[model samples]
Target chain A: MLYLIGLGLGDEKDVTLKGLEVIRSCARVYLEAYTSILTVRKETLEEFYGRELILADRETVEQEADEILRDAAVSDVALLVVGDPFGATTHSDLVLRAAKAGIQHHVIHNASIMTAVGCCGLQLYNFGETVSIVFWTDMWKPESFYDKIRRNRLSGMHTLCLLDIKVKEQSIENLMKGKKVFEPPRYMTVNQAVDQLLEIVQNRRELGEELALTENTICVGLARVGASDQKISAGTLQQLSSVDFGGPLHSLAISGCMHPLELDMLKLFAVEPSTFEQINIEDSSTYLS
Target chain B: MLYLIGLGLGDEKDVTLKGLEVIRSCARVYLEAYTSILTVRKETLEEFYGRELILADRETVEQEADEILRDAAVSDVALLVVGDPFGATTHSDLVLRAAKAGIQHHVIHNASIMTAVGCCGLQLYNFGETVSIVFWTDMWKPESFYDKIRRNRLSGMHTLCLLDIKVKEQSIENLMKGKKVFEPPRYMTVNQAVDQLLEIVQNRRELGEELALTENTICVGLARVGASDQKISAGTLQQLSSVDFGGPLHSLAISGCMHPLELDMLKLFAVEPSTFEQINIEDSSTYLS
Candidate 1:
């Protein structure tokens, strides 16, 4: 059997009891390392699970899937993923391939940022479609996610913006040169995401489109969710762009319509409680009791 | 400190190692019994955890939250919730109150239906706003969810309909008589939800409104996700309504535009592969390569 286990958002201890049991019994365990990074080191997880893990990069998983599934028909083989197994479409594709090969497989679900964003005092049911914000280059700035946020805002729903993380990425120059060298990993900060969002808002305003957010628009910044030192801060886009949310794995949420109760809960994380109150008054219709 | 731990959607062993550690050291542990249920009985969980659990129904958690948060300031107190701790808004409110009361708290996130629905081969990012479908009564037959599903369908996004479950509910007759008796627990089946949805579609058709879904619309029915006996089936709404999902806690998904890859994945669970192929050809635009 091939087991796709989720090593949730935190340290090694976040694995479910069932997942741990499966990992212990597995003959070979592979950890998909490119999609997301765990807070703890690989060594820490190895120590906790008492087994050596084979690091499977994107090329290995995408090109050598047959090798990964070879012995699964007779013995247990586990592919551990950060967050939920199906959080990424590639994992689903892997499962589909497993099915085609007649290999038995099971998924052990765990927390992903898709649901952990609720820790910022936002209701999960109230969130509309989630969008990802990729790192912008000098010539390649994408504004498609802005339109999604607008649609969600018009519908009075929150939007979760997953910040970008570039892992094992090759430089364009190196790609042209066919070099196998990889650049250092880069994680997008909340400030960078907000700056890109504001840039989109500016371009849209220039095109005479009504905007969903502004400098004073309330937003929440979350860093290292599901970890002990997790930090959540709520404030306007302008205020958040200046605050330093230490470390990687930051997420931002653009508030749409809010219930009074939601506002009350969010106020606890406000950079300046008085600013949050003033914004609530300026746009009273945005919040309902 | 107050610890809000999630018991993932499975039997007793689904809790994370982190959550189990917290529960083991906590002075008092209370399980919220109203929101959702674990597959195993309370006794099973008790045996696995080696500790008796205090069942906190709606009243205890909502009205007497202070009681649950009482000794957390001095000693560890845990409130166990099925699925992720913040899957419901009331839990967020409880966390907010804990913050206001100067109590330090932590949330141990776990698998939630919001992400676990991916087990049905539907991509998580393709899902739009999720809606809840309640059991329709003669007087309170709500059709608001139909509108949400229509909007999602129009946007070419899948919609996950969370079937409502009634626990510890008192009937109007009993309430009127001032009787303390409670009604038997009721969980909405995929069939019941489809019936109500079709009723709304019929009403909309009579009103000359364009509809996004019909009896022929494709849907997926999932039962007891994350459990060993978890089942997933895909077919038209008419076909799925006849499927015996077995037991409580069923969730339905209305398919919106599918990627050819998604269709391929979903085909593994099709009620009839030929019917699925015919539907794909008839509504080719609903899927993109």
Candidate 2:
């Protein structure tokens, strides 16, 4: 049996009791470490699960999947992923592969930033399409995600912007030199994401285009969600573009039609209560439950 | 401290180690019993945790909230929710109440259908706003949710329709008599939701109006997700309307634009492979990662 388990979005203890039990029963455990991350160290998880985990990078999980699935027909094997297995970048291909190989599999679900972002007070049902905001380079800056956010806003729906995380990636110089060296992992902070977002608005303005997003648009910055030290702040895009949200694994939500209840909740986390003066909060007190 | 812990979408074992520990440590533990449910019984959860459980129906959580938060400021208290704390319904209001009461609180996130629906081959990021389908009566057949689904489909994004569950609800007769009698729980099945959906499309057609949804629209029906006997089926809306996906807590996903990879995964659970003939699966082979 091949068990694909989710370790959730916090420390080692975030793994469910069932997931931990499966790990104990599995003959070999592999942790998929590419798409999402846990704030705790690998050693901490190892000590908690009482099993040595093999860190499966992109190559191992994508290229050497057979090795991960080997002998699964005879004994149990587990591939633990940070967040829900299919939440961030999906591992359904691997599950499909296992199905083709006639390997029985099960999925253990856990918290992903996808839904956990609602803790910041936005209603999950009100959120529109979620978009990923990648790290922009000097020569290559893509703003296609902006259009999606605009559409969501136009529909009076909230947009969740997933910040990019470049982990175990090699530099262009090293790739050209055929070096195996990897640059340090980089997680996009909400501040940098806001900067890119503001730049997009500025560029569109320069072209005399009226976009739904503006510097005064209301946005919420969330960092280290589901952790003890999790932080959430809400304000206009311009107001949050310079404010630091502390550490990594940050996400941003550009809200559209907000209910008074939502604004009331976001009000508790506002950087400046006065900045909310411009937000047009909808009156859904009669409907919001 | 007030701990709003999510018990993932399964049995008692689905609770995270952290959530379980907090429940054990809490002076009183209340389970939110209205919005969602776990397949396991309350007694099973009580036995596993070695504590007597208090079920908090809608009234207790909404009107008698002070009773729940009475001693939360001085001692630990937990409100265990079925899915991710903020996934199905916005618990932010309760959290807001706690904040106003000066009670420090913590949230333990867990798997929610909002994200877990991706397991059936849909991409989480491609999903748009979620809508709830309530059990319609002769006079109360509301189809306002149809507009939201149309908006989502217009944007070429998937829609996750959360089926409603009526637990501990009072009938009009019982209410008028003031007998305090409760109606038997009625969970909206995928078939019923589809019937209402099809009816709406028919009504719109009668009115000479166009809609993004139709009998031939592709969808996925998921039942008892995260359970050992979890079921996932995919086909055209007409094909899936009659299929039995087993017990409660079913969710339906209406697909918009599809990627080939998504089709491949959905194909494994296809009710009839021929139904895929109408789906224009996009070639995202080069970009999907």
Candidate 3:
């Protein structure tokens, strides 16, 4: 039997009771570390679980999944994932492989940013398709997510922008030379994402396309969500681009049509309470009644 | 401090260690019962947590919210919600009210069907806006969800349809007379949802509109997700409508354009192995190589 457990977004204590029980029963445990991350350190998790964890990087999981599944047919083996097991497509692929191999598998679901983004005061049902914003390299900048955000905005739905985290990445030059040296881990900040989004808006302007977002567009930046020190600030794109959210694992949300109550709730987290009134184009007073 | 904790899908054991700790520390705990429910009985949860839970129905939550929020400013209060705390907009409204009352609050996130639907072998990122399918009444049947599904399909994204569950609902006659009588709990099954969807497609056909889905369209039906007896079946709409996915809390998903890998994974759960080849319009043979 194989258990794919989710270590929910916070510290080690965020694991569900069922997940903890399964982890304790497992003969061997592997932590998939490359996709998303928990707020606590690996050592903290190890201490809490009272078991040693084998770190499964991208290469280890992608190339050596068979080894992890070898003994699962007879004994319980657990692979812990940061968020939900299926938050990333690779995990789904792993489950499929386990199924094909005739191994009994179970998934213990936990919270991921997909649902936790609701903490920003926007209703979960009102959110449209979510998009991921990757770190822009000089030559590999992509703006496809811009149109997706536009579509969501046009439909009067908020959009959740998942920030990129580059871990164990190799430079293009090193890949060509077959070098194993890896770059330092980099997590995209809300400021960096905002800058790239602004650049895309500028390019679209040059191309004579109507802008989906502007400098005064309402945006919310959340950092270290589910943690005690988690910070959420709502402001315009221009204001958010200069705001420091502190630390890694940040997310951004572009507001669409806002209900007056939603506007009232979000205003409490605004950079400046008056900024909402100054820049919000929506007639929020209509919903006050 | 007020703690809004999510009880992930399934039984009491699905609650996170952090959520459990908070519940234990709270002086008073209220379980929000009207929005959604767990597979286990309230007694099961009370036994597991060793805490007596105050059942907060829709009327209690909506009309008597102040009672729930009272004393939170000086005492620890926990409002337990099935799934994520913000899965429903009313929770957000509650949070806003808490803020207005100057109460310190925290949200403990948990797994929701929004993300757990990935257990069906579909990538979460590929899912577009989610729609809710309510039990149709003789006088009021809404087909707006059909348009939403069509939009998602046109965008090449899957659509997760959240089936409605009516608990502690008052009948129209009783409500008109201000009676205190309540109706029996009713949960919309996948079969019922598919029937309504097919009826909508038939109506569209009569209106000379091109169909976005048909009886042969691939669909997946899931019941008691995240529970031990959780069941998932992938088949054509017609086939799924006849399949019995036992118990309550069912959900449906309409397939959009499928990646070959996704199709492969979904085929493993197909009602009939040949059904995939017969109903899948996409050329999946190319993916076999």
Model 3's DockQ? 0.72
- Put down candidate 3 lDDT per residue, B189-223, tens digits, no spaces: 99999999989989999999977777777889999
Tens digit of per-residue lDDT, candidate 2, span A59-97: 999999999999998899999999999897798778889
> Scored by CA lDDT, what does every candidate get?
0.86, 0.88, 0.85
Going through the candidates in order, the fraction of native interface contacts each one reproduces equals 0.78, 0.92, 0.82
Clashing pairs in 1: none
Q: Considering every candidate listed, which one attains the maximal lDDT?
A: 2
What are the per-residue Cα lDDT tens digits for candidate 2 across B166-230?
Answer: 99989999899998899999899899999999999999999999767887788899999998888
Q: Between prediction 1 and prediction 3, which has the larger DockQ? A: 1
Chain A only: TM-score per candidate: 0.96, 0.96, 0.95
Residue lDDT tens for model 3, A38-156: 78888999999999999999888889989899878999999999878876434766777788899978889998888888888877777888899998888899989998999888778
How does candidate 1 fare on TM-score?
0.97
Better of 2 and 3 by lDDT: 2
Which order, best to worst by DockQ? 2, 1, 3
* lDDT against true structure, model 3: 0.85
Better of 1 and 3 by lDDT: 1
lDDT by residue for model 1 (B12-122), tens = 889999999988889999999888887898889989999989999989998999999997889999999988888643487678778889998888999888888887788
